[model samples]
Target chain A: MSTDTAPAPGAAPPASDERLREVSRVSRLLSRPELGAVVGAVLVWVFFAIVAYDNNFVSWATTAAIFNRAAPLGILAIAVALLMIGGEFDLSIGSIVGFAGMTIMVLSFPSDGGGFGWSLWPAILAALIVALAIGWFNGFLVITTKLPSFIITLATLFIFRGLTIALTRLRTNRTQLGNLDEVEGFALADTLFASQFEIFGARFRVAILWWIGLALVATWVLLRTRQGNWIFGAGGDANAARSVGVPVNKVKIALFMTTAFAGFLVALIQAVQFTGADTLRGFQQEFEAIIAVVVGGTLLTGGYGSAIGALFGALIFAMVQQGIIITGVDGDWFQVFVGTVLVVAVIFNNFVRQKAAQR
Target chain B: MSGNGTPLLEIQNVSKYFGSVIALEDVSAFVRAGEVTCLLGDNGAGKSTLIKVLSGVHKPTKGKYFFDGKEYNFSSPRDALELGIATVYQDLAMIPLMSVWRNFFLGSEPTKGWGPFRSYDSEFAKRTTKEEMAKMGIDIRDPDQTVGTLSGGERQSVAIARAVYFGAKVLILDEPTAALGVKQAGVVLKYILQARNRGIGVIFITHNPHHAYPVADHFVILRRGMVYGDYTKAELPLEQLVQMMAGGADLEVLQHELEQASREGGEEAEALAETAQAIESELDELEEKGND
Candidate 1:
């Protein structure tokens, strides 16, 4: 891939082309798919500004709502993006989320028809254990079987989904869990999640802050840490990375586990914040997370992506979800819009990637 | 150093088998520090199997392996690496997208401080990688540059320098110049010599006699999983080494077949003669192709 070299012994080496050197920097910037996405984002915002005339279109409330709704999805997207960049996938995340949330609900088991005897720490710890176990299971199976994660996790998705349905039915013969009267459950949801802080006169939930923290942490890991390098190397070229002693299998398994943990954390938050669990909770949410990650310029085939990109991708999705309502368009059209964005982002990302490779 | 240097690594009575198929049988070779031990063989001549054993990708089914005068049996590639036995495979275990410094310090990345707080010392990594490569006569100004952007020869040099920097007692280069252009091949051959001069035991595996004849202090030839011959630099004759690898008997038969076809001349006979002439040229090449 390197061009700098002396001509082989007998041949006349060609002179360095200054023009090629000058263009290299430009090419390097364009290689980051985020650049094109940024451009696309700007274009979309301008289009909205011009076309969307409703008061909600430019309102502070609308903006906060968009960020708020996108926060959990953003966190999930960042996790998936990291795994995708590492060349693996976790279809079990949605189930892990359901299970983790259910575990939290179960831990806060109301003793007297209202209050859980346990504190938040114990509940959180229990949730973490369940999440990590699910994650570890995903990693273990994927690594051991050496099968496509898609198939492995797909099977897990069904297993978890079926388990969720069965347990919910057996416990209450109903779809949702609710006993909002408990003080412990109430405090857990309100203080840790439902609680809000004011910024620029717009109320933002702690969940959004958590989402931002996740993105920042993910960004740091992907860029600054050795683990991040291994993820890229593993996905880019597993054999090459293994030969270099990158522990390619371990890195991939860890990624799967991380994705599952993120899913579980999100589910736990949802359960605590909402004060209940729904049997149908987290259904098809994996596709939404994948959509957000893809929109953020993360390659579906893995090897290159960013947590920041995925966050912005989630932002884009949330914006459109809110924007469509502000425009008074049918809510069902939202899927069409997401579908369009997904295809366009994928195509645009491929182009940017190809250009980057050529450079 | 002794007159010809002491053996840094020695393999005795090594035999490898995959099911009923014998890959290497009763093969013995020794690599001495400050010298190149060239392992030459034609395709399907057990070179790959021998390397797998040497590099710890495989443990010889039956053998006594010695390194630094100590017995060894490596369970994994990492174990081999920890023993200061480094192998730069033909493709070179390099991550193309990673920066030169990162690839240089791939497995053994340097860290500052200690314990849970220890982090990679990027500055030291970049500085030392550049400095060391420069010392190797490789002028890589920016260690931040991705290895994917380097030429084949330069990649090989980096791989070599990395192995040495990591304190490899013995460097086994698997056909470093096999895929390179003539000039690129020459550049790599020069590095093999450099590694030797640094008092590193070098086991250069190649079928090319031309590349090996000049640098090798000892030569080991393998055929059908068995050693055809072993010769020290003083005893090794380049032509004979080439002839052995080419399957001397097969080459003679090919030449005889060619002469009989050429002597029976006609339009059809001429075509047969031309085919025979081609076979003769191939046999003729066996004489110097190894050296070339």
Candidate 2:
């Protein structure tokens, strides 16, 4: 019985040579999914830092500006990453941003400006409620009707954008809402959403802090919570997860809501900073957020990604967008650079995932 | 036999219809604690549909379902889980990219702390996963290793261990050994025995009589969506069980037809008759041994 119980063929390892084992261990670490994003971020940072040396692109002020520009996209990308990992997409997120900003603007603008003349807090609350409702509707539709979120949210994307445009035109007779700075209680809301602080002699927007905070919280939730486990299971294989009693539908719905909430946050920040809202404020933002998420090493098919990877991805985007101008390159090349980076990042992520699975 | 207790789960005269098609018809089986009820069938024998009904993925269109001798209706797999019926699907109910410990505690995670501060207890999950697997005689190199990297047999063991550790009173495995090699199938069969030894009723669904005979305490043979035969281990020997599963009556008819064809003389007919005679002798030898 004891001899029969010996390890089955291919079950036991050969005698371990310490050096070879150490080499394999290091190789395993290098093949982690996020390694691609980390490498991409480093290469972009170094290249830009060298090329734009004359512009002081490496200096604190320029770095702060880059991060400021990356902040909103970073926040949205993190939420989108979570959604993607949970096996869904929200093409309506950009429209949600525009709708949310429009909500805040129209509700807070003075009565003379054909607005509700509401105080800043009420307007902010109303905007948040609307964002939440849109998110819930998207989630409900996907779960109850069993349709792809891509198609459902795509339809809502146009519907919401059209509603924003029509609502603004009907109520204010214009496609823009302005004069937010003069609204009652604007100062407090501004401080909360659009304030700036000095850090190491660099002017940093509060949105950067919000971005970092959300990323940290997201990472913690994904790595340390039961809900995070459910998210992964839901995305990986819904049927398998359902067999084990994981509430795959609920997890997906919550992820949609989280993405929408992130959109609202970004819209609120942009609205406060500009003291107005444009009907097309968040045009194409949905694609950009998804690009950042993909660049961060999240699988397009879902069930695998990291919040920190998304942070690095957002950082890479900011560097390229700002670095191109600082280096005296044609602005058109920014799009080219972004496209190249997206392709390379996806290829690198695929290679890493394959390598990691090999062992 | 089988602890001589009330059935843990009983499906009586269950019939399932999907639209105008019959997926399962008049299938009945009872599983008792501390025993393994092997549901054997060939492909298209409604084994999958029967397992789905038992696991609460579908409700029988006509039948009475009983758990612990009381009538029960489960609307979803979640409801079945609440009643201590855990299912180990053929896919192993796992996220391939996740670590073994994470997959082990996928749905029913253990949490520490209180309220908002409460979080998954990673240490406990890892330790428990490793310990449970070890109890089944599986030595996992690392709990943090992704499940996708594990071999097919290892994945099946992990799924079985998970079901046992999560307080399952009855375990339903859907073709657990169907995709495995001979040795890997042996590994899963060992785990099935381990689960049964722990006083949990196990429903082992498979088509292979060789894999089922070693551990099964009771056998329910299904054919064309209905139960063809039911027998305890003492009443059904391994050869007879294999014969039943392979549709013995059909094989007998084929042999008779070949013998008749042989009388109408040709080289091909003579060859067919020779093959038929060989099979007849083999069956007769087995029957003689069975009598002995």
Candidate 3:
């Protein structure tokens, strides 16, 4: 409602009205969580830059490698971030990655040849279908049974892990998949995953570009798309959203599928690029993805997060992971540092969320 | 009733029950373009059930409803919304974390492009939201601001503006100023008038009679799940309306008993008199409270 009173009927409008300007000023700073994250990102970048430059750790190659490694994680983080923003989580994504890769590898193998025959396109398609189905199953349980996602996805993680073990044994009595060089469509699949290009005298993999493109699309959807708006509404207040006509369950299901699709994409990339799969593949990808999204300023409680922030969060994560190696720090200590960052990022994000919620 | 402008929504002898409890009975209301109808009742007086019936959250068990003068039955709120009946609740029926423009176009968002891959038109949404808010005499600074950041009254205004922009011919508001500061309540009341001036029929539901007294073309009062009275604006007497809402002669008898005890010269009697005085003041303050 307008704070200013309405103009009297048949009366001349005021010439020097300034109420509109005041309201415009107040509404400009909308979501504190995202704005704080943007500022925090810049500050973190500066701090890291100082550390890198002081240690003579600044190099174009280092930067490229950082992005190259962070790219896949960034893609996964975007997916997880969207899910979190839409008010759910997927602990099963880690297992989904393993399952998707294993599915592709086993399918590529000729059943009679005792080796992966590698009909790449069909294998990839089948893997994707399986991953989507897994996502749908997760959603179905979440909606129908009305269980918390944490417990649902935890059950899924174990189930998928156990299935992987049994399926591997049934295939070749071996825990690893191998010998898919003879598969049809391998070249096209390989190119999509393992291709490289040179930019500004720095070589980067196709996956990094893919990550950037995905981030761009995600950013647009979050800020400028109608579905993106529904994600926020449904996550923010499911009952309120529904009363106003938002389809809460559908949005959540779509988010789950998106997360699964991201895992599937990552699995395909890893398989085609490395040309192999193992039972243990992607064992902790879900935690890493969640950490990336949380550090990107997404709330654990759902609603109020940005895709770009998630990408930067992933960037920070990869920077630390690779920067430690470049600085000759023990790789084992990297996990400890990641835990600390997660705690700090969550605290900062929560503070911003609180500030934003206040009138 | 607008003769040519047929009632957009009409409920005839509606009755609703929750298991064995009767929520509403023999209730009727009509909404038409170019007017505001105020529904007034105390808490537990069946206002909510009545609004639910109109909004199609629940179908009345014993009534016939007409939309655009055609008999209608709705299975869900979505069905009612599709027929251009929008209900803005006290909470504004919006996601607080979402930007104003985004909230303005939540479920029925305007999209560009084609087919399943169609993209939302951001520029259009922002521009149109800004224009509509301005038309409602609201001076919101940015369409990108989250609705949470706006004042409670502003959020209510945005919801009203959204409904109007989306072509809601019948707007049902439930206690729009029930939880607001005095100024904030005035702000929402102004928006109610704005909606009325726009020729969109409005059903303003509230417990506060003063809120309904000024702007309502018709007033319908409910008590214990049934209509106590219904009157055109000209037929309403403010004093009589107040007394009726205060339980008529029963309250007067209680006042007499308290006065008799006061004359007996006991501390308890004085306390009772003070209590009676407090009630009298509350009755006087009802006008002020209703403004909020």
In the predicted model 3, the residue pairs found to clash are: A1-B157, A23-B141, A24-B141, A109-A116, A109-A117, A118-A183
Best by TM-score: 2
TM-score of each candidate? 0.87, 0.89, 0.85
lDDT of 3 by residue, B16-101 (tens): 99999999999988877867888989889999999989999898889899988899899998888888899998864778778898
Over A98-211, each residue of candidate 2 has an lDDT whose tens digit, in order, gives 999999999988777789989998999999999989998999999998999999999999999999999998989999888789888889988998999998999999999999
The TM-score, computed over Cα atoms with residue i paired to residue i, of candidate 3 is 0.85
Query: Which digits, one per residue and each the tens of the lDDT, describe model 2 over residues B136-237?
Result: 778887787888888898998899998887788999998998998766776777778778777889999999987787778899999988899999988998
Whole-model Cα lDDT of every candidate shown, in order: 0.78, 0.86, 0.80
Name the candidate, 1 or 2, with the larger TM-score value. 2
Instruction: Write candidate 3's Cα lDDT for A75-178 as tens digits.
Output: 89999989899899899998999999889888887777454565788889989999999999998889888899989999999999889878877876778876
Listed in order, the DockQ scores are 0.20, 0.34, 0.34
lDDT of 1 by residue, A1-359 (tens): 11122223453223343444455667677867566566666666666766784545676777798898899898888899999998888777888788777666655655543325465568768878877877788888988999998999999999988887777556545566665436354664578766788888898879898899999888877765667777888887788778778898888878887888788778866776687777667888888899888888987777778888888888888888878878888898999988998899889888887776666
- Candidate 3 segments exceeding 4 Å error: A1-56, A112-118, A199-203, A349-359, B1-6, B114-118, B249-292
Per-candidate clash tally: 6, 0, 6
What CAPRI class is candidate 1? incorrect
lDDT string for model 1 (B1-292, tens) is: 3145558999999999899998999999999887789999989999999999999998899999998888999999999888889999877567777778878876566665556445566666676777678767787845766788888899999999988888888999999979887567767877777777778889999999867876787899988889998998678687677777788898678768877876764477777556645543543354233333
